[model samples]
Each structure stands twice: as C-alpha cells, then as structure tokens.
Target: MTNYRNETDWERADRNIGELLQELRIAIPGVQVLFAFLLAVPFQQRFAQVTDFQQSVYFATLLLAAASTMLLILPTAFHRLTFRKQQKERMLKLSNRSTIAGLLCLSLALIGATVLVTDFLYGSEATAVVGGASAMAFMVLWLVIPLRARRLG
Candidate 1:
C-alpha cells in the first residue's frame, strides 16, 4: 500500500487534482448533452403548451445544467490562466474545491434531467418518484461511494 503520510503535500494534492479532472471528464459530456436538450426545448413547437409548473421545472433544470457545466469546466480554464505561475499546489487545492462544486452541480443536473424526462413522459407524480430515485442514486455515487472507498482503501 502507498504511504500517503510519507508523500509531500504537493504530491498528494496533485494526485487529488488529477482524480478530480478524470471525474469531470466523465461528467462533462453528460451535462453538455442535457444542457443542449434543455436549450432546444424552448424552440420546440410544444414548448409553449407545457404547463406553467412544467415550464418552471424545465427552466430550473436548464439553469442547473448550465451551472454544472461551468463548474466542471472551470478548473481547466483556471489552470490555463495560471500556468507557469509556480502555483501547482494552490491550483490543486482550487481544482479540488471546484470539483466538489462540480459534483454538486452534477447531482442537481441529474435530478433536473430526471424530472424533465419523467414529467414529459407521465406527470408530476411519476416524475417525483423517478427523479427522487435518480437523486438518491447520484447521492450514493457522488458522496457515499467516494467516502466509503477513501475510508476502506
């Protein structure tokens, strides 16, 4: 097993930052697709016919998707802006924080996608059940699994 305590702080921070970037790579595509779909909804013929509550839900979902996408992408932009500044340690810490923000955004985006799909397919009742389940799963994957892995591994 690797001796984490023996590693320099910068080494540990670099590893953490790398892991975060990998996670964002997985998350970004999904969020982009969702955001694209949300953007197109307003252009659809049936968009105006959607109920007010559904419209509100759709708007909220779109916003969350947008925010998530931004959060996930911010670290890359930040790194580029700070490149050659000898700030790897600071960059790593900021990247990790951005990653946490991105995860929260991702959870919200997933819930929003679930809600948008379910509401379109059935109604609020079914949407609640489906979206709630998806939210729970996101929580487990984003929060529980990582915590457990870090603890056990």
Candidate 2:
C-alpha cells in the first residue's frame, strides 16, 4: 500500500522534515504578502468610505490572514526551538498539522478579502455571487482535492 520508497525511520523523518521546510518556504512568502496587503488596507483613502459590512469583512479577513501568517511561520520557529532534541519526528507531525491549519485560515482570509473587494467594486448581490464562487474554488482546490487524493491513494 505504500506508494513511496521504503526507508528507515531516520531517513523518513529526514525526508519529511525536508519536505516540510520546502513547503514552508513556499507558504511563508505568500502568507506574508497577504498580511502586508491587509496591513496596508486601512491606510487607503477609500477605506473610510467602506460600509459597516465591508469594514467587518475587512477586519475578519485581516485577522484570519494574520493568524495564518503566524501559523505558517510557527513551524520554522518550532524547528529551531526543538533542534538537537532528537524530536524531529514530533516536529514534523506538529508542523504538518500547523500547516494544514494555516492553510485553512489562509483560504478563509482569501474568501473574505475577495468578498470585501468585490463588494466594494460591485454590490452586495455581486459580493455574494463572487464570494461564494471564490470560497468554493478554495474549498475544492485546497481541501477536497487533497482529501480525495489521500482517500483514493
């Protein structure tokens, strides 16, 4: 049932850690970009013209993006803190979970931010249509596809 090459425990742990680190390298930058954009939103002149709902959506999106950034970066800190403790396996496992959680937060943040922007440009009905579609896209791409792959494989 194993689709991967068989290896010793240490080898597997090393490989997993390496893979996690590489993945973090991809995730961290994207999360930081979202965080930076969200951080700058309030300073925009049009921000003050936002309706109450839009402001709420913006804040929610910002908070989720911030949380995602923290979660995405935690694995690096966790690895550093736990280095030389002979706990690479634990680190890998925990970081994997953290990455998943971070991704979920990121998806939500993207959905809310998209909705806020779309609503600003269009209207509430347009926001609902665009946001719903965007959320579904993320859910399918991020969650459903991965889960289905794991289940089928």
Candidate 3:
C-alpha cells in the first residue's frame, strides 16, 4: 500500500480501529436486544406449544445470537487486553475477521427469528416463502452488494 493519506502505520491502525468500533456501536445494541428476546422465549407459556421444528429453530437462533454477541464484542476485549502493547495491527486484523463473522451470525440469527415467527403465526407454508425471502434480502443487502461494490471500486 502506498500510504495515500500519509499516515503512519500506527495512525492507520488507530483509524481502522475507530471505524470498526463505530460500526460495532451500531450493531451491538440490535444483537443484544435480539439475544435478550431469545433468552426470554422459552419462559413464555405458549412456547411449550411450539412444534419440534420451531423449537429447533429457536435454539439455533438463540445460539446464533449469542455467537454474534460474543464475536461482536470480542474486539473490545482484545483491545482492552492488548492496550499499550503495540498490537494495534493484530487487533485490527482480528477485529476485522470478528466483525465479519459476527455480522454473518447476526444475519443468520435474524433469518431464523423471522422464520420462527412466521411459522408460529402462519404455519410452515408461509414460513417457507417468508423465510426464503428474508434470507435472500439479508444476503443481498449485507453480502452481495458490499462485495459487488468493493469489486467495482
């Protein structure tokens, strides 16, 4: 890289970390809220009436949300542990991977949640259509468009 902005390595790392943290700030709360809701689902009286498939989906979605929460918050922990150790580059690399994986988990969790709700409300017939559509929307909006934009740029 040509250091187009004339920033030192440390400066670049700092900038990247700042940007990543900002992105996480936007994502963290949503995942947290979803995780909270998932945590409470089984406590609801009606939850006992869910089909086996719905139960499976619910568990998987809950796990996905938990994974997303951990991955999304990992950078902060890493930063805290590695602070002042001149590990910004490593932190940045790890944070980038963590963020991507976190977002993937979050997307899948959202899809699962949607499918679960749709199935509960309108049965498997509607769930099939709505779930597929939800998955497609997330994939296109979150993954395809960004990849395409990067390729084009």
Q: Please give, for residues 3-122, the per-residue lDDT of candidate 2 as tens digits.
A: 367777888888888888898888888888888999999999999999999999999999999999888888889888988999887888888899999989998998998999999999
Model 2 scores worst on lDDT over the 10 consecutive residues at 1-10
Off by over 4 Å in 3: none
RMSD per candidate (Å) reads 2.8, 2.1, 1.1
lDDT of each: 0.82, 0.90, 0.96
Worst 10 residues of 3 by lDDT: 1-10
Per-residue alpha-carbon lDDT of model 1 for 1-153, expressed as tens digits?
Answer: 246477776677677778877888888898888889889989999887788877888888888888888888888998899878878877777777777887798788778777877888799899989988998998898799999999998
Using lDDT as the measure, name the better of candidate 2 and candidate 3.
3
lDDT of 3 by residue, 34-153 (tens): 999999999999999999999999999999999999999999999999889989999999999999999999999999999999999999999999999999999899999999999999
Which candidate leads in lDDT? 3
Q: Roughly what TM-score does model 1 have, to 2 decimal places?
A: 0.85
Q: How well does each candidate superpose onto the true structure, as a TM-score?
A: 0.85, 0.94, 0.97
Model 2 residue 47 CA deviation (Å) reads 0.8
Best of the two (1, 3) by TM-score: 3
